[model samples]
Target chain A: MDFTPQELLIASITRMLRGLNHVAVGASSPIPGAAALAARRLSDGHLRVSVLGSRKNNFFTDGGRELFDCAAQGRIDAFFLGGGQIDGQANINLVGTGGYPRTDVRWPGSFGSAYLYFLVPRVILFREEHTPRVFVPKVDFISAPGVSEPNVYRPGGPYALLTGKALFAFDKARQRFRLETVHPGFSVADVEASTGFEFDRTAHVDVTPAPEPELLALLRGPVRDEVAETYPQFAATVMCGSDDKENRV
Target chain B: MAEHGPIVSLDALAAQVPDGALLAVPPDYSGVAMEATRALIRRGVKRLHLVAVPTSGLQAELLIGAGCVETIEAAAITLGEAGPAPRFSAAVKSGAVHIRDATCPAIHAAFQAAEKGIPFMPLRGIIGTDMLRYRTDWRTIQNPLAEGDDPIVLLPAIQPDIALFHVPLADREGNVWIGRRRELVTMAHAAKRTLVTAETIQEQSLLEDERLAAGVIPALYVSAIAEAERGAWPIGLEGRYEPDAAHIADYVRTARSEDGFRAYLAQHVLAGRRAA
Candidate 1:
């Protein structure tokens, strides 16, 4: 069965979230949102997914601070972080490139990554465009570092990085990413040319497995419909096919 | 009537905000008083040291573009799905506005410190980021309680002169129902004065109801209230209505240029188009 790139990404990310208890996705992260929902479906509703900006998905009642407060207490199991620039050390810069206060190119300043990155254990670094501009040797600014010193009370850091090109698992001890699986249709050479940082790759890097028919059915059915509530545009353009008259199918 | 008493007109609510006051406003989803924002612009309230608790969206952009703000401290400011906020970016790049870049929890923790009437609060993360370098007000010290070195960042309390936001309802007693958005309560608690714009002011007392009492900021915290139906227009109030995406898209397009932004202001904001 043919699938869109978004479907591929969603499936890949869901696999990363296999045993996680609770996954929280932030704003403008439809792909992660869908993945978290897909993970929940796979877990038979065991996995709790909180997608910010969605009333149904999020269970926080105290307020916006609840998510951070909960994470500080180590309630959130997995979360996603993206950056305009991500370095080899797994340092991510959500803030723009250049000097402070007056960056030449400003994306958005780091929201909660500065806090959540340290608190949430499984921080999945995500960004679709995997070019050198994004995957830099050194980020102009470090919104959150991938590693902290021994004394820092950090229970969390980067777990793995999923990009359009491939998936790289962060080797925390080594402070470098190890090439896990290159996405289908992309070669190891293709990933190498695109990536700015060097990573440890096995002699034989396997292609990422295609989405199982069961997972695809689940994604195309309930997950697609559910994610559409918060991310209509992404669902419409990426998840839903022109031929998908019956979404439940 | 006292400045803090009863429901006032939107203009009157705006008038209470003195020039150059440190104003605390919640993020877009929390409850943004867009109508009151327009009222402030109409009143030409200037030099507001706007604090976007955690983050912000169109409301901050509108305020900055209209020259109502001198400084803006936020973790991040964007138009969400619409992409980067134009005016905020322009203002920052041109040095038109002073930017005190912050992280989300630091901002929240600061407000919490103020709410607790503390001088500062210690936060765990933000140790390695440039946010620490630029934010001189935020200091790093070894954990006083720990025997060994456990450095943490200390954020000074942020007690804004005024806190303003829109909510779904306010009672006759001046208590406003904020539902799950308790950041508004923190904003109310941290600020010296809390001005509110609500969709409706019912005769009923909010605190009297059991279900809503937990969500309601009692009359003591709410200084004044203004009944502006659809107060969070274009941005939309959570649960009440969806954002007018088409209108906001038009704004995103129009506000890309100075001339176009002014035209948008004249037609949409300054044209006596109060939130109806």
Candidate 2:
């Protein structure tokens, strides 16, 4: 069965979350929430998922609350975060387009990214676009850093980068991002052509699988339905699909 | 000074509250706020309207265990338990508390409208949602002066009789300073009378810091102040001690059954009663 890129991305995230003990998802975060829910139900509730911003106190009888507060209590082992601009070193800048205070374009800034990035151990960065604007050589602002340069590690750093065409992981030994895997329909050349800077790419690169039938069903059914009902803008985006297919910018 | 009003203890503040009186609490379930809630329940208050972001499993358990509050209404419910717990499910079914998903803006607007001596405010985005139903005071009033548009629903301001908050520091005069979370600002601005519970009573100079001073709840608005250590017991402060897991677990267990909740309340809150 042929799957769309978004489906593949959701499937990959669901797979990664399945391996973790717990997951912390943020408010208005459709991808992470869907992935976590999928992991929990598919994995027989083994995946402990917690969602933030869905409740007042961290403890409620709602599904979103159960998932988020659990993650906050260190119950979550992994967390998924979305980035607007990410650098080669896995530094994420959700604050603005460029430097802090002054920037080319300004985003909403990091809402819960600062706290969530600091606390969560393994933060998987996901973005629908994979272009120079997003997957930049260096981010404009240091909203969250994957790894500190030469100084002591500060708060709000991303750990991994998951893009539309490729996947990147932080190489602790070299203190840089390395090409971990590429998508099924894309090649090394395709990835390099889209990215702004050069990356260390070994001969071997794994392929990200397409979404299984079950995953596709889940995404289109409960996931899409819930998001559409709750958040209208996000739902519009989901229905419209990414702006660019070949180079998701 | 009226015998200091019997020196309200940390555990007995709730009992001091009058029945049918509106009570406003902080958004998050910090330990101090939780302790205050436990106290309020012991006072035998009948109706509770929590000004919170949403409810969590632990909080639901706590409310259920209190057994005093007959009806509860809040913005949302956060499920804290892993998977579905029978006890937690039962609480929702019992209709003791009704959960609604309304944002802080709606809550703030409601309070602001009340404070300004207005009836209601016309809020956008929540038109077709369940919030309209939950907030029955909301009404669809026609724009009589308009040419040809449909009527708009106006949300009535929710002016609670009392607003109680816990913070990191406070002055003797009841001025409060919350470090990171500014949720208390909404409650303080919206409520009729604001009460504060703090970890420490700091010198007035602590408010000199430009950043910290901005978040201070002024003495003019605050009615009462108390200093208590580990006051936010079961729920921890941001940079402070962790939540009491044992207490949370006990709350979960005790709140599971009505009989268990009554017994738990008797032992923890009522039994050790001191003069109030």
Candidate 3:
């Protein structure tokens, strides 16, 4: 029962998106794209997945504005966002590090993460790098805050943060992250050592569930092929589909 | 009238843009005007207010590296999956360029305000965050009409001096078919001038055909047009092709240092100065 890191992350994310009607995966997200496909497949296509920047997966015939419009109308139930640095407060920084305007390390500016984070009900904060540098005490700049003021009209915010080591669910009431599960082969201490932000944890932590053989087959087979249309290089290398390079769109 | 049918060379189009212009460009992975960016570098255009319509990638990084940009106002400027934008990152780190960071909706709302000739637009979110703190232009005010404790953020309009992009077609009438990339239309509507590069000059007017008419950015808004096939090179265009992955990867690798970036400009931009 050996699964790649990508498969594990995919499984974790799919479980987070249990009954969401429509899940939207943004550009540069191959892992989430695969997970969305898996969720849709398992739900008998009852779940709708819109993979932005994908020619085949996207059904927006109107244009680029449709994605935002759909989210605003509450049609999009789930979305994914990542950051260069994520903190305990659920503040994520896609912008540069160090300070505002001037920074020692610069990342991309926030795209639709801020807007969609407010609109999408289940905003999953995901990042593959699970170290202190990424999981910071405080993010340098907040691209999208995990919780908004009481008056702000927001239907969505951070639900859970999935990383290489563990999964932490955001408690909006407490404005903190609680350790949900540590991935297989990783310990609570390992997560504690790597995570810069403090989080409440159960005395007995559960290992992340492994994907069943059926799910595994779907991931390696149809799901990988679907993701390759948008992220050819990622699908090629990450999903162990190096042989399927020619099949990429 | 002079601009209505001006299908000039890429050089001519780039030359129209002078120093210290607030230029609005599209995001990465959609209608990125890369050829024009390269030309702007070759022209040594200086002190540009580079507005990344919502977000950006190679185009912003290339300009920042060339030292042609003085300010960048955008959401982010990474090379997407290719990783960090080396030049943009280095410039910000060194305090070489002014960075005005805002969220995606703020940028879009600004454009929307400009499109409608409004002073500002109200948007949700940014409260209880650093985004509102760093942005002096953003203001939070009590909702005069609301019942209780309701405050909202308002963003001033972003009216750029120029809007530039590449597309699949622009007919003789200057009507450019943008397909589903509606942000370009908003950018064109918001900017004072718009420059477009195209893969093909259509034989029939885009407006004449109902199927294509829905996607056309009316020639009324297009001030200049250039026939630059693969104009969005290294960047992808919807329905046309995938981003030049090898080229994007090369840009990430070569743009890591000042010298490497200069070498890239020499090979791709300055050396190919045969545009005008």
Candidate 4:
């Protein structure tokens, strides 16, 4: 099946969330949300998916704090985080470029990352635009450190970093990202050229497998409809050929 | 005696909020009092210390652009799918507003501490990040009970002067039904005073209904109530209406620059108030 880049990304994310009991996707995250939904579908309703900002998917009854509370109690197995800049050590900067307070450029401030990056065991760092600017030598600011001191009460940290170009697994013990696979049409040199930070690569980097026909159908049909409920623009524009204006949320 | 009396006009409700007040507001998806926000803008309220329970959107941006906010304590401020909140970004870049950067849980935990009448609340994480350095008010302490060298961050309680939000219903007796969005309850509890604007003033007391009693924030916390129909306009109230995406898109476009933002304020906010 001819799959879109978004579908491929979704499939990659879905595979990563294989064993997680409950996966939570935060606000303004369409790809992660779709992938979580797909993971639930593949898990035969075993994997619980909660997408914030969605009336149907979210199960938190105690308002906004419930998600954090749940994560702190180890209820949430996996969560997704994105950054304005991500460094070699998996330090994600959601704040902005330049110094504290007065930044050269300002992205959205860190939301739950400071807390969630500590509690939730598996945090998939997803950023579509894999450029030197995004994957930096060191982030201008660390909104949430990828690793913490031994004394810090942190059970969660970076597990993997997935970008448009390649997939890299975070070696938390070593405090670095190791290249696991390069996506189709992208070479090891391409990943190295685009990335600003240094990373360890496997002797032979594997090609990220394409989405299966069945998975593509699932993504296009059910996942698209479900994701459209939360992110209508993403669903309409990027989730294959769906131009249902009425479904625009 | 009732904690609050009869419903006031939207402008009157806005008047209750003093300039430089520490005002707490909800996130966009939650119940946001957009009409009340416009009223605050119209009144030319200044130096507001905005506490966005966790995060905020158009409302905070609008206030910042209007030069109402002096400081904003929030987890994040973005326009959701519409992209970055332009005015907020501009203000931060120019150092127009003092930002007390906080994580989502820390904000909630601080509010929870305020609600519980505690001086501070200890939270895990935020140990090595720059947030620790910038947020001087937040402190780190070793766990006294633990045997190991366990370190945790402690956030001081944030007690806002006023907590304001829009809801689906507010009873004549001032009991506001917030449904599942219980963050409003926390906001009301954490603030010194609570101002509420509702879509309708229901005839019966909300607590009378056993089903709704759980979701209702009793009149004791609510200082005043105002009836403003379709109050969460453009942002929309849950189960009531969808967000006016086109209008928001128009706002995103118009709020890109100072001149355009002023034009928006004139046409949509100041002028619309008269018609409203």
Candidate 5:
């Protein structure tokens, strides 16, 4: 069965999330939501995932009171985050560009990357595209840490690195990142070609599998509907990918 | 030059901050605050305090990592960090600094207590939980005419020594226009000194929008103002940039491991301080 790039991306995220007991998804992130839904439906509800966004689930939400109360109470086991730029060590930067006074680009990233990255034991870094622009040799700034370099420990660092082209698992032993697997359509060469810097590829990389039919159904159904009502921009983006019609196989 | 407090450079502002001073920080504005913390830490100030709503992002991590004076969880879940760091968790539980989870009403009660120059305010909720145990400074009083009933706890007023906010714009006299977000207002009214760091220093009259004008942090409350560009890099302002993954990764690698944490401080923060 052939799957589009977006489908494959969602499937890979689901696979990663399924391995965890619980997960946290950010706001307006279709990949995170779709993946969580896919994991629950495909894994037979074995996965317990929680969604956290700027807006509280209910109106009576306290301002900074229950913040991370879920995680503190051990409700979440894993988390998914996105970034504008990711570096070799897996640090993420959604902030400003190089040259401080005037940045080259700016983005509206979720505010809690530092807290989430620091607090969550396993944080999966997901991005829509894999390019030199997004996957840079070094980020202009450091929003969260991927790997602690000499003297950098403030708190909340990234755990895993996920990209559109390939999947990465950080190796603390070597102090450099290693290739875990590549997306189904992408080859080692394809990933290497996309990235500007040379990555360690000593081991053979596996190809991520497609989402199960049941998983895709969950994503296209309740999850999609819920997210659409919550975030219209994300709904519009996901809807553009494929027809909402259910697939009959 | 003006009737209000002086405008200082980033270095001067960093130097002026005293050691062990309680700093009230916005829950989500970590990117901007970290740079300031780094500057202050470089100048050898310890025992910082943070006031924030728990959201998963850069600001929350810095507060935990830097070891704040008291971290009041203003939100539902501490959403900032993806997972928990054992050291930070231990710190919260052990009460080196206080970590309280409460509602907006409780927060407002505490701030109102500070504004009114009171020691603490009695609240009905948060009666029988771990929140009571850790907040020992908060007193408990008997309910009038109620027998065999547990007493309600009183949350102490949070009058911070300084309220430091990083926003989009400010005037030379430290008249801050927070744009649409009013998260800093409570700190402004509750703190003894208010310091602001802005992305740009525009004229005072640039605040023309009626809605924005209503949220201004007046010069009377603000003691110092400085211009810090890309101030919220790792932390984010709604319309501004995102976090720096590389830097964050470096911080994680260095801080998560004990040896890595020491090495990181030695090289980046400590060494940089020596150089400066």
Candidate 6:
């Protein structure tokens, strides 16, 4: 069976968010959008997914306030965030790689990750590029820190980080990231070579499960359409064509 | 007819803006009053406190480049998919203006606090970052309401002197249809006054139609209204038209250097090519 790397990641994230009540995907999160859409379809509409850019999917009438208000009130269960650089402590740098006032590289400054990371219970940190530059020892600027002190009124933080190479679950108590699984066709060594930060490496990491035929069908058909409304470019590019799937078999 | 009604010209409305005013503007995607921005630049406004609520784009860049802004408080400023906003990046890097780097919700919450007439609003995250370290205004306090001594970040309320934005339509009665872009409404409520530029002027009250009524920002909040067709040009008016991508691309290209930026200003803005 041949599947896209995105499908593998989508399946892994969907597995993590088994019974969430509601998930909101913001800005330019196509993969997370697909996974949320997939999870919603899998649960027979038990899950409510809101893609911010989509006119049809977004339920917010009051601009950014509705999203924030909902999150503050604990109505939103999960949200997806990405960064220019994500470190070992789950600290994300959306601003840039070097010193923020004047940086070597300037990514788009942090949009809502700093705010969303605090309110949403399950914050899934997703970045496709797995490299030393992105996975740093210490981010030049902390757009949003992964962990908060005991006294801080934080209901949410990083639950897991999904990269192109591996998935790591964040342990808030210890403020450490534990490598849960390495994607199939990739090894711990591959992760080690590319990553800049040190983390708790597990001895026996499970291979991320591939999307089965049923899941693939759902992803290609309904999930693709649902995601297309918000991420037309992503859906058009990433969704596995039926002809390609038939040929693969 | 409506007793010193809201209808006014861009310059007349822009003239009302006092020196060193804290002005709130909309994001790039929404109705950004480019006409008003040009007028502000031409007026040689000084030491302006420009607030983007959460995020901004070319408007922030344009103002920063034109030297009309003295302080910028925004979560982030980018050209969105078009790429990094060069002028804003250079301004921050060069330490041209005082930059208060904040998160999106923090900005939103600050405005919200002002809208609610509160002193400050408590937020959830960024207690551990360097961004928090530099912010003199933000303070961390333990949750008094919660059972345990939980800490929370408190953002000071932002009360802008003027809230300026563009709209697709405004009635003679001064009401403007903001539709689902209620952030404009929030800006209006938070600011002392709101100035609007509508693409078209509606003769009938927008409140007459139930559908349009719901989106109307009542005349009471609006200080002045200007009829400027394609007012948000270069930046889109949302549903009215797509952003003039070619012109914006040119802005990105020209905004790279001081000389290029001057040329850009003289050619487009100083020429008053699109002035309404």
TM-score of each: 0.97, 0.51, 0.94, 0.97, 0.51, 0.90
When just chain B is superposed on the true chain B, each candidate scores a TM-score of 0.97, 0.77, 0.96, 0.97, 0.77, 0.96
Per-residue lDDT of model 2, residues B136-237, tens digit only: 666766655667654555767777777776677876545687654555665666777776667777656446778777767677677676666666666666
What tens digits encode model 1's per-residue C-alpha lDDT throughout A1-249? 677777788889999999889999998899999999989999999999999889889889987888999998999999999999999999999888887678898776899999999999999999999899999999998889999889898999899999998999999999999999998889999999999999999999998888888888887788889999888778887787546544321
lDDT of 6 by residue, A65-143 (tens): 6888798899999999998888999999988766656676766677788778888999999999999989999888888
Model 5's TM-score against the true structure = 0.51
Best-to-worst order by lDDT is 4, 1, 3, 6, 5, 2
Q: Write the number of the candidate with greater lDDT, choosing between 2 and 5.
A: 5
Candidate 2 segments exceeding 4 Å error? A1-249, B1-16, B29-32, B53-61, B79-92, B95-104, B130-135, B141-152, B266-276
User: Which residue pairs in model 6 clash with each other?
Assistant: A151-B150, A151-B151, A152-B151, A153-B151
TM-score winner between 4 and 5, please give it. 4
Tens-place lDDT digits, model 3, residues A1-249:
577777788989988777878999988888888999999998898998899877777888654556777888889999999999999999888877776678777777777887888888889999999999999999888888888877788888989999989999999999999999999889999999999989999899999898767777898899888988888888777788435444322
Q: Please, what is the whole-model Cα lDDT of each candidate in the order they appear? A: 0.90, 0.58, 0.85, 0.90, 0.59, 0.84
lDDT of 2 by residue, A1-249 (tens): 655666677777887776677676665466666677667768876666655543321233322223433434666577776767777777666544543233345343343343345446678888878888887887766655566433222323355677889878767567677888899878988888888766777888988766788876766666665545333345556634434254332
Q: Per-residue lDDT for B1-276 in model 6, tens only?
A: 233678988888889888799999887756899888888888888889999977888888888988888899888888754678887777777778778888888888899899999999988776887778878899988788888777788999999999999999999989999999989988998999999999998899999999888898999999999878888878876677777767887788887888999999998788874634
Q: Which lDDT value does model 5 have at A103?
A: 37
* lDDT head-to-head 2 vs 6, winner: 6
* Error at A99, model 3, angstroms: 2.6
User: Model 4, residue A196: what's the lDDT?
Assistant: 99
Residue-level lDDT of model 4, residues A96-186, one tens digit each, is 9987799999988999998899999999999999999999999999899998877788889899999999999999888999999998889
Q: Tell me the spans in candidate 3 whose CA falls farther than 4 Å from its real position.
A: A61-65, A241-249, B1-4, B273-276
Question: How high a TM-score does candidate 3 get?
Answer: 0.94
